[model samples]
Target: MKNKNLSYKFYVIMSLSIAAIPVVFIVLSYAMFFTHLGITSLFNIDNHFSGSVLTTYFYIVFFGILFGLMFIAAKYFKKIIHRINTMEQTVRKIAEDDAFPEKLAVIEESEDELNKLAASINTMIDRLRAKEMELSQMEDLKREYLKQLSHDINTPLNALNLELYLYSQNHNVSKEEVDVLYQKVDYISKLVNSISSEALFDIDNYYIFKEDISVHKSLKQTINKWSYLLNKNNIEYTIDVQKNLIWQANELWLDRLFENIISNIFKHSATNQIVITVGDTLIIKDYGVGFEIDRDHETTGLSVIKNICQKLNIQLDIESTNAGTAYRLSQE
Candidate 1:
């Protein structure tokens, strides 16, 4: 495609038009000397007519040529303006990155530079559309994978939970720490149930349009619901949350994220008390046996928590090298 700028081709046309003037005058001058050219001879009018009649003929011939040239220039400029309009619309649509319409032919029917430029742009846009389709197909594959994973994990966990429940009650365990094992099994089962639906695994879309929610309120609600379990486990916990610390999040998802983390803290850590400090960031510190970072069995909860924190742009800081684990969240 040729460059669309007027200077690219229009200058050539204008220069030719200007250069033709001297050549045209020279041709007329020779014609006048040899053929005795006049309005009468040029138009084959009556030679006997002279003075005022001859002057009138000359005026008519001069004005007729002038009007013809003017008309041609006007028509040329009008076509150029129309091409400019078409190119403008095409460029705007491409810049907007709108999907190209079917049968949307951006053809360069004219041999003009502007039309050729538009045709080139349209060709590039076609290439982009192909890549876009490929990306879309890849996204579909990802969704299917997540959906299949969820379904595969869902059905088996229920039966596993029933087996574990029976084992916890019937086995007559000697160790008090057996409660932690049972708790881990039950929480994992619940986590499986919650994520059984493929829609919730849409981490990419979830945080994009997350609504503003009360971090403190959701935490309190989740804590209240889990109070019975905490008491049964005899795990002491502290809450020091700032009033009305709002964050952009899905409230239910945030609650679930906290539930998984807290449940793991109670199950894995030999903590007498866990302290939660909510200010600029929400912090959960457990003063107990520190996590090995790699030996934890609550992989399901950890997976869910990690996905949520990452999607929501929430910073998840874990300190596990010390006597306990500390999880802190901040806005990214």
Candidate 2:
């Protein structure tokens, strides 16, 4: 397109110059003819004819040279304009859709702004692709974590529901059996509460607060809360802790944690006697069915244990087997 424009311009200039030759010739001839016709030069016709002829010859030679130069310039300019138009269209297409063709026929101009634009666009595409991949990976990890958490929460929930249904249907069931059923329900509730607390912490970074906590009082209260279950289940348990042990933490959260650990012992351990010793250290030991260390360590119970240990700045040591399970928590 540029080449064509340049050619047209050259043609126009050449045509104007050619047309000027006749005008110049005419002007010089008119001047000479007028001079000859003048009263002072009425007999100078020969001089007028000679001058007119000479001017006409000069115009012919001038037009020939000027036309040649115009033609050459027009040809090259046309090529340049064609290349520019092609590049312009390619760029417009790329702006509309980034995946537009790459092989554009551009002029061989060095280090131009268009070249830099293309490089920048390519770099941007690369970065976007990388970010997309990262987001996909994150989504996959989130899905897997949710699946595991659901499995952990549902298992105990199912067991608790079944036990409650049986107890409700058989009013004549022994008190001993009813107590065991209630203990199972309590255990499930504590587990659910722990999961809920952790979830709230993850999302909101705080738990609902009930203030003025007394650690010793809370422990005793929690024990009394589960006293009926322990007594009817024939599980001998004792609490030996100082009465004034106090701390700054949410009372409800701490109560739930204590309840969960103790209930876990009742549900899973096969021991008839459990002992709670609280002083500088808090220990809950069961002489019933102990934990299968290798198996229990891999359980969700251990995960809950780890989270609680970290939160309370306590150290947890567990020793278990078919013989019994002993869990000891030490202040740190």
| Model 2 worst lDDT run, 10 consecutive residues | 105-114
**Global lDDT of model 1:** 0.69
lDDT of 2 by residue, 69-185 (tens): 678768866865776676666557656864544555333433444444445555655666577689778766765675577667767777877767786677667665565556556
| lDDT of model 2 at position 56 | 68
Q: Tell me the deviation in Å of residue 1 in model 2.
A: 25
Q: Give TM per candidate.
A: 0.57, 0.42
Q: lDDT of each prediction vs. the true structure?
A: 0.69, 0.64
Q: Which runs in model 1 stand beyond 4 Å of their true positions?
A: 1-12, 19-60, 95-98, 102-112, 172-236, 240-251, 259-273, 277-332
Candidate 1, residues 1-332, lDDT tens digits: the string is: 24345665677767766776666556544654444446658888666543463455445654566567768878978977887776677667766756663323454465655656767777777887888899788878866776787668766766776776677679775444454555555556556545554344554544245788888788876676667678887878779966667788865568678888887877777787888888988989988878666565355257667877886778887888558889988884
RMSD values for the candidates in order, in angstroms, are 7.4, 14.9
